[model samples]
Target: MSNSTHISTLIKERTGLDVGTQFRADLETILHDLAKGDLEQYLADLRATNENAPPWQTLMRALTISETYFFRDSAPFQLLRQPILPNIILERRHHKRLELNVWSAGCSTGEEAYSLAILLYELLPDLDSWTIRLKASDINNHAVQIARQGIYREWAFRHTNNGFQTRYFDPAPGGWQIKPHIQRMVSFSQNNLLNEVPRPQFDLVFCRNVLLYIANDFTKAIETLIFDSLIPGGWLIMGQSEAIRWQRERWTTHVFADATLYQKPLPHQIMTPPSRYPIASIPAMPDYELALDALYNERSSEAEQILKGILAEKPGHAPTHILLAYILGSRHALSSAHRHLDDALNSDGMLADAHYLRATLFLEEGKDVESREALRAALYCQRDHPLAALMLGNLYASIGDMAKASRTWESARQAVIGLPPETRVSVLSDMTAAGFDALVKGQLGIANK
Candidate 1:
C-alpha cells in the first residue's frame, strides 16, 4: 500500500474517524510539511518510542479548534439571566454570605470569560456585596496570551452597539480595551480539561462549543468531568448544539421561555424524562426572523430600525447588537458599527460571521493596515474563514505585493479544498475571477511553470 493509504488506514483503525478525501489530502500536506519521515516510518517510530506520550496533547490541540466569542448562543445567557441567577440568589438569600462561582472551560481568548463578568455586573445591582468568582481556562498558550491582554480591534465588536461600547470599553492605542473593573472580575489560566487532579467546584460552568471536536467517548468523559467539577445543585451549561442524555438523567432539566438549563438534582427533586419532541418544533419569534431576513437582504436602515424595536421590547436580546453592527457597517457608519460589534462580541465572541464582516468593513474604509490586523484576528478566531483570506489577498494585490497576495490565496485555496465539493467549486471560481490565477501560478507552488 502507498504511504498515504497506510497512514489513512491506521488513523481510521485507531481513531474510528472516516475523513473525506479532501481532509486526507490536507493530512498528507501537513505530513509533507513536517518531513520527519514517511507515514509508515513515522508510525513505526511512534510505536517504538515511549510507552506513554503526553496524552497526545499536540494532536488534541490541533484537532480541537477552540473558537469562542463574547455571549455565544444567546439562549444560554438568557437562561442564566432569567432562571439560573434568580434561582441561585433565592436559594442562598438566607446565607450569611451570598456568593456565585462561574468557570468557563476552554475559554479560548477570554471573550466568554469577560461576557460572564459583564453579565454579572448587569444582572446584580449590588454586585459589590456579593462574592463573585469567575475563572476561565484554555489549553492553548497563544489563546491564553491574547486573553490576558483583553485588547481587541474594532472588528472584534462588529455586533455590538454604542451604548455597550460607552459602558464597557475604553478606546485604546490600536483598538478597544476592556475596562479595569471588568478585567478584574475574571482570572485566566492554562488548564487541560482532561486534568487528573480535580479543580475547585463551580456553581455555574460554561463549556460551550468545545465538545463538538472530540470523539464521543471523550465528549462523555469531559461532560462527566464537568458534572464532577460543579457543586451539588449547580448549573451545567452547554452550547446550543451540545446536550448530555446521561447527565440529564442525573440532573433536573429546566426549560426557560427561550432556552434550556440543567441543574444537579436537589434532595427531594426527582429528575424528569426529557421530552421526546425536538426543540425546533417550537415556533420562532416572527419579528426576530423578519429582522434577520431584512439584515441578510442588505437593507441596513430597515434592519437597524427593526433590531432597535426588538431591543426596546427585549433589552437583553444579545443577537440584536450583532445584527445592528452589521447594519451600521453596511451604511458605512464605521464608528457606530464598531460600537454594536463590541457589544455583540462582549456578549459572545465566537460569532465568526461578525469577525469576517468587520474585517471586510475595515478593508472598505481604506484602513489597509488595520484591515490586515483584522483579517488575521478573524482567521485566528476561525481557521477555515475564506472571506478573511480572500480580502487579505485582495488587499495585498492592491498594494502590488504579489508574493504576499499569492501566499494568502494559497492559504485560501488550501482552506477551501477541505470544504464540501460544492463549496470548493464556488470559492475557487470566485478566487479565480478575482485574478487569483496569475498570483497562484506566479508565486504559489500549485501551478507548473
Candidate 2:
C-alpha cells in the first residue's frame, strides 16, 4: 500500500475516522509535516503506541472539527424547548420525579453542553427540586480541559444574542466566565464514542455534526451506542446536515416544524413511516427549474439556452435573469453578468439574490469595497441571507477584522440551521443549505486556527 493508504488505514483502525479522498491530501500533508525527514520511523512509532498517545492526539486534533458555538443551531434547541423536553418533563412529573439526564456527545469545548444546562435552567421553574445530570464528553482531552475552564471569548457567544451572556455569565480576565451555578450543572469528561463500555441512560443525546467525520462503517456502531444510551421514548438530536437514515426504523422519527428528531420507542409501540414536510401547493416555473438543473449538472450552454428562451417569453422574470447572470459569471463574462443582474434588480428591487450575485461579481473583479457594499445591501434586503453573510465574513477576515468576521459567519450559520439540509438557497446557482453551512464551517475553522 502507498504511504497515504497506510496512514488512512492506521487512522481508521485507531480512531474509527475515515480520511476519505476529499481529505487524503490533508492527511499526507500532516504526515510529511510530522515525519520531518524520516517517514518510516514515524510510521513505525505511530503503530507501536495506543491512540491516546501524544502523536495520536495531535493527529486527531488536526482531523476533528472543534468549531462550535453556544446554541450552535437554533432549530434543534427550539425542538428541545418544545415537545421533546416538555414531553419528558410531563412523563417524569407523573412519576413525581424531577430529574433530567442529558448528554452532549462530542461536545467540543463545552458550549453545547452549557447551552443545554441553560435551557434546562430556563425551562424548569422548580429547579431547586430537580436533579439535572448534563454530562458532556469529547475524544479530545484538550477540548475537555478548555470546557472545564468554563471561560470563553466573544467568538463562542456568537449565537447567543438574547442577553444570555449577561444573564448567565460574568466578565472575567481573558473572556466571560460561565456562572458557577451553571458550571456546576455539567460534568465534562473525555470519551471515545467507539468505546463499548456501559453508557448512561440519557433522557436526550446530542451527537450533532460529529458523525460526518466518522467512517461510514463506524457510523452505525456509534448510532447504536447512542440508541442504547437513551431510555425508551427518549430523544436523539442530530445536526442539520446529519441524519439517522440507516437503521432509522429502530428509532421513531418525529418531523417538527423546524427540525427532525428521533425517539426510542417503548415496548410494543407501533412504528409509523416518517412524516415529510408538506409540499407547497404553488407550482414553480418548470423551465426555470430545468435551467437550474442544467446549470447544476454542468451543462452551462444548455442552461444558458433555456434561460434565454425563458427571458424571450417573459422579459420581467427576475429568477431567469438571475440564473442567466450566474451562467455569465461562471464563464468570466462580468459585463454581461452585471447587465443581467441589473435587469433582475430592476424587476424586483428587493431581490437579495441579485444583490448577492452583484457582490460575487464585484469580488471576482478585485473590487473588495464594492463587494462589501453589495453584500451589505443583500443583508439589508434579507437579514438571514446565508451566502451574503458568508461573503461578508470572508471580506472581514481578509481585512484583519476577525471579531466581526466570526460574528458574520455565525450569522450565516444561524440563517441556514433551521432549514432542511436539501433546501435550495441561491437562485444564482444550486447551493443547498447543507452546502452553504459547510462553507461557513470552513470559514470558522480557518478563523479559529
Candidate 3:
C-alpha cells in the first residue's frame, strides 16, 4: 500500500479522528517530516521506553490553538458598553432583581473573561449592586488553570497604558498578576462547547473567533445551543466574519454603528422570516489595505472618510471600524474614536487593532485605568503587538517600575524580531540604539547575576 494509504489506515485505526481528504496536503507534510526518521523514531522510542504513553491531551496541546491573548478585540466590548450591555441592563432591571450573566465560551486562558471583568468594573461603578455573573469555560484543562491564576507576561499588556497598569496589576516573579478582585469576577471551568451542555441562561453569550474551525453542522449545533442558552431578548455576539448562517427567523439582527449584533426574540414577539429576495445588496466593503495606506500617508481625514464609507456599506466590517477607530483616535476625536472602536469590537470579536487603538484613546483621554485595561485586551488578541508593548513598558517606567518596563521593552524587541526584516529594522531604529542597548544590557546583566 502507498504511504498515504498506510498512514490514513494507521491514523484511522489508532485514532478514531478522521484526517479528511481535504487534509491530504497536511498529511503529506506530516509524512515527509516523519520520513526524515524523527517522528517515527520518536514514536517507536516512546512505545519501547514507556509501557503507556502520555494521554491524547498531551498530544492535543501541541496541535490545538494557542494563538490567544488578552482582550483580543476591542470592538465587541465597545458594543457591549454602548448598546448590547446597556440594553440588557435596562431590560433586566425591570425584573425582580437586576442580574446580568455572561459566558465566554471557548475562553482559552481567561483573558477574554478577565477583559470582560475589567470592562464591567471600569464602565459600571454600580457593579456590586447588580447581580453580575461571568463564567469562562474551555475544553483545555491546562488553559483553565492558567486562566484561574490570572497572571500574564508583559507582552500581554502591550496596548495598555502606564496608569491602568499601576492600578490593576502587581509585579509577580516573571510577569504581572491580576488583582484578586478582578479574578474573582470570573469563574473558569473545563467544558467543551461542542459536546457538553452549556450552563444555564445568560444575558449575553460571547462565542467569538472560534467557529471558523468547526464543521458546519457543529457550528449550527453550537449556535442553536447559544440561542437556547440566552434569556428571552438576550444577545448573541459572534466574531466579525461569522454570520447567523443557520437560524434566519429566530433572532433579529441589530445593526449598530459599530458591528452587527443579534438580539433574541422577545417572549411575545413573532419570528419573522427573512425576505426571500435580497432586501438590498449591501456592497462588500473595501479591504483594510486602502485604509492602512491612507493612514500611513498621514491622510487621517481621508482614511476616516473611506472607513466610514465602507462601514456605511457593510456595518459588520470589523477591520474598517478598527482602522477608523485608530484614525479617529490619532485625530483626537475621542468620542467618535471610541464609537468606532466599539463598533469594531461588536462586529468582530477578534480584531486586535481595535483594542490597541482604544487603549491609546483611553490614555490620551487621561483615563489611565481604562487605558491599561484596553491594553491588556489588545495584548490578549495579539501577543506580538509591538506598539502595545512599547506603550505598556513606558507606562510601567512612568510608575517607577523600571524592572517591569525593561522586561516589557525586551519582549517587544523580541516580538519585532519575528516580523519581516524591514519592519524589524524600522522598529529597532525607532527604539534608538541607546534605548535598545540599555534594555538588552540590563536583561543580560540580570541573567548573568
lDDT by residue (212-293, candidate 2, tens digit) is: 8888888988898999898887788998888895798888886754567888877665465543222111112457657778
Candidate 1 C-alpha error for residue 243, in Å = 1.1
Cα lDDT tens digits, model 1, 1-449, are: 76656654544344333332426557776544443556666666434543123322343344346566666767677556533565466456545457889998888888889989988886554567788889898766567778888887766666454577667889888777999999999999876666525454689998877765545655666778887778877787877777774655887675543456677655555544542111110011346557766755656577678878877866645556656776677678888878777766665564444566677677778777887887776665544455566677777877878778877877765554423343222211233323443444454553222
lDDT of each: 0.63, 0.79, 0.63
lDDT of 3 by residue, 1-449 (tens): 65545544443333322344535567666554544645555445433432123432343343246456666656667656543454455445545366778888878878788888887665444567767789888766777788888788877777554555656778887678889888889998876665556554788888886666555556777788888888876777887777787966778786543456777777665465331110111112224446656767777677777777766765546556666666666668889878877876764554456777788888898888788777777666555456676677777777777787778777666654433343322211234434554555565355335
Q: lDDT, candidate 3, residue 181?
A: 85
In candidate 1, how many Å is residue 190 off? Answer: 1.3
What CA RMSD would you report for each candidate? 20.1, 20.5, 21.5
Candidate 1, residue 146: Cα displacement in angstroms equals 1.0
Ten contiguous residues with the weakest lDDT in model 1: 275-284
Q: What is candidate 2's CA lDDT for residue 439?
A: 79
Q: Pick the candidate with the highest TM-score.
A: 2
Candidate ranking under TM-score, highest first, comes to 2, 1, 3
